[model samples]
Target chain A: MERTPVLRSEWLKIRTLRSLPGALLALFAATVAFSALAGVSEASDPGFDPLFASLSGVIPGQIAAVSFGAMAVSSEFHQGALRLSLAAVPRRGRWFAAKAAVIAAPALLVGLGAALAALLAARAGLGRAAGGLSTGEQVRGVVGCGLYLMLMALFAAGIAALLRSGVATLSLLVPFILVVSFVIGDATGTLADFLPDKAGQLVLRETYDGTLGPWSGLAVTALWTAAALLAGAWRLCRRDA
Target chain B: MTSIDVRDLTKEFGGRRAVDRLTFRVHPGRVTGFLGPNGAGKSTTMRLVLGLDRPTAGSATIGGRPYPALREPLRHVGALLDAQAAHGSRTARDHLRVLAASNRIPDRRVDEVLQETGLASVARRRVRTYSLGMRQRLGIAAALLGDPEVVMLDEPSNGLDPEGIVWIRTLLRRLAGEGRTVLVSSHLMNETASFADHLVVLGRGRLLADTPVRDFIHARVRPRVRIRTTDPVALTSVLARHGHDAQEHADGHWTVDGARLDDIGRVACAAGLPLLELAAEEGTLEQAYFDLTGAETEFTAQHQEA
Candidate 1:
């Protein structure tokens, strides 16, 4: 069958889900709120990077992003919905690709809008401290923040598919992004730069002193997302719905 | 028109075969009841036919093509594997809408099915709030959304009221009347007898009987004679001497298998026994089904022990 109708069906599923839109709303609000707070309080720190601080609200907001991805895939596993979906489409690969496309598009759009709002909100508090940021730095931070959030959402979605349980995906990811990346990140030194969350966040930094540059950091995160998605696709195809 | 053809289909889970080289064809313009006991693999066979699970051996096709090979499969074959398969958070209308959109079916067909299934009033309600019978209606609405040539439902009459059951029976007959192939699965023989024209019976992952409903009963059912006499001992002796398989009931009635009512009465008259009552008993579809599946179960048990 042609792919357009299947994609349209998937898009309808996402839009009709009340919790999904709520999660996106939470993503936007959390990102903007936390960035404003970081700008006000963290601006006094001697080592503060203005670009990173302005976009730092994504640190907390990305939780909602992860949830959006995980829930979208997990709902299909609930109540034998996957059986109905596959029966209608019959081609598991095509249905899965359509699902991925719907998830990616919404996450990317909302992530970009949220990042731009966070940067402006935080810059309001940073005042003179944020003045050192050049236009190029600000643009990179905004764009990188959006892409980073979208990647994290996809990363969570892929893991959810692999695990076949949204609760498990959230349980594994929320902790890894919150505790491992934040607490163990410093102790691991350069190794932490390759972790999905840390690597992606590096793109938001104005200047980095690591083996990876900004774009390469996002590329590493993309690699992690790709691996997770591949594993999910394999499991979906191999198992009986 | 699409017809389901399953050839040597086998499915094994963890070394235990669920469907053992089962083969059957469901033709159009009639209701084919997929009959089996629990775990007899009726659902598994349906899943294989729909390409939901890969068969361990052989193939299942619809209209000369595998299920996955069909473009817009919903328009080719519509199936309801589980009544509760839809997401609870979505409204019944949206559930059907999602399925219709997948096959490029017209949006109005969704409303038509809901109306046909008598769920138009509750179409906007979330499925979580629906009763089991209501959920069944929603499932049926989904199956009919594309107006497909082939429709398959598994245990669809479960949790339905008597009226709902009758509704499904009429719906199945109407679909078959339209020259569409319909396959419905259930463990209850009497229920299937009410609506199905042909039956495909399974026992212990194996095919037990495949024939028309009337022929199934005629072939599997054994007619017997129920006799009551004034002198029990003399009549029993006479019946025993005549080589009849007669068993005494708790209510003082004797049922003689493989015996004619007239012959039993004549023999009793010649033996000088006064017959109080003598009548022929006709076997029903329920009894016939029990006889076939019950014997198969015993044979399977002994075969396994061997």
Candidate 2:
């Protein structure tokens, strides 16, 4: 099969499922609702960072994106469609690459949308409730938030590829993103900044500190995503489907 | 000719052997029936042949190449291992469409297969709403979408009604008639009796019989002359005297093997044994299968004792 055709086939397989729309809706709703709420609450604090508050929606919204990524690959195993897929493109590496590319497209689009919506909602809500973020800081936060969400989605896609089970991927990822980040952040104090979510969130901060700057934090998250994807690719290629 | 060839193939899961030293050849222009009971390494062998499962030893090739080596695998070999494994939300047409896209099969060919498989009416319906038989048909349609040179179906008749079974039989025969290699796996011998010209019977991960269907049947199935007589014991004795193997059934009927109707009549007349009914009973494929696998049957006697 031609590369373009394989990609098209994988895209159709990913999009045809009802779960994709459901997951995308969940991501949108969570980002909008949480960012709006965070923006309003943080408006009263004196040292509140409007940029960070605006991007706060990503904390919860990424779970939806993670689910989307997980289901993209896991659905094949669940439905036994992987057999058909393998029958068509027997070259495992090419098939995996096609699937990865197709999955990344939606993840990137949905993640960007969620990140943009959250940033905008938080900015409007916080600006009206208290004071608006400075123009430069606001732009940095919005851009960083978009990149952060995309990286988070890719990270989840890697995890999904490794686990190859929707429930297992969700179970493992939810705690790491939600609970572990808090536990490590509270216990390690300054050291916790290196955690995946914490390090990645540094990009959302309006004021850039020498410690874990915006671009650097985004790079950290990208590195994590890259490492996970490499591991997943290795596992996928070596293991029997 | 397009064919599937396995040479000393072996697959091991942990310490247990799933398929051990398995070797077989399925040639084109004939429907090769793969027969085995449940857990007899049938699916494992197929997985190995398709390169879905790695072999611990040996190799399986299709059309002289491994499955993973084919540029367009579906065009070379179409396989349906599971029928109800498709996404429940996708429509039948979409399911086939996605698979067809992999091989660049035209949209018109998709519709043709749907029409051919009688799934055109329900083509737009979600697969979740389909019955098992309908799903089987859809799976077959998906397999045929590429118009592959070799088609392998694992238990295609499974979950089919009588009419569906007949339809599948005809379809397989037609595919083989077109000179494509058609390999169908079934536990039930009767299902493949009329359609399969060549038979590959496996028992406990070992090849029991690999020969023509007719030859296997004739060698394994014992034809009996069913005789109804007023004096069953007398007829049995008379048949035994002629060196024929005869047994008196519980229903007071006599069944004599290795003897024709003429021999039975002659023996009966000489012994003055009155025969009410005498006819040769043609053995079915099921009986032939039982005789072939009778020694290897692990549960029959246990069930009888139970």
Best by TM-score: 1
lDDT of 2 by residue, A1-241 (tens): 4798899888888778888878878887888789888976746677666677777787788788777777777877675677677878877778877877876666667667777788777767676642556777766776677667667766777777787777888898889888888777756466677776778888887765647888888898889888877777787777776
lDDT of 1 at B153: 94
Kindly state the number of residue pairs that clash in model 2.
1
- Per-residue alpha-carbon lDDT of candidate 1 for residues B161-223, written as tens digits (9 for 90 to 100): 999999999999999999999999999999999999999999877888889999987777788
User: Chain A vs. true chain A, TM-score per candidate?
Assistant: 0.97, 0.89
lDDT of 2 by residue, B1-306 (tens): 789998998888897777778888999999999987777788888888888888999999998988888877777788898997788999999898898888888989999999999999999999999999999999899889889999999999888889988999999999999999999999999878879999998876778889999898778776678989887667667777788887777777777776677877777878888778889976777978877777755445344632
lDDT of 1 by residue, A1-241 (tens): 9999999999999988889988999999999999989888856667678888888889899999999999999999887788999999888888888988998888888889988998998888989988888898888888888888888888988899999999999999999989989898876587888999988888898878878889999999999999998899889999998
Q: What's the CA error at residue B266 for candidate 2, in Å?
A: 1.8
The lDDT of each candidate is: 0.89, 0.81
With a 3 Å backbone cut-off (N, CA, C), the pairs that clash in candidate 2 are A79-B85
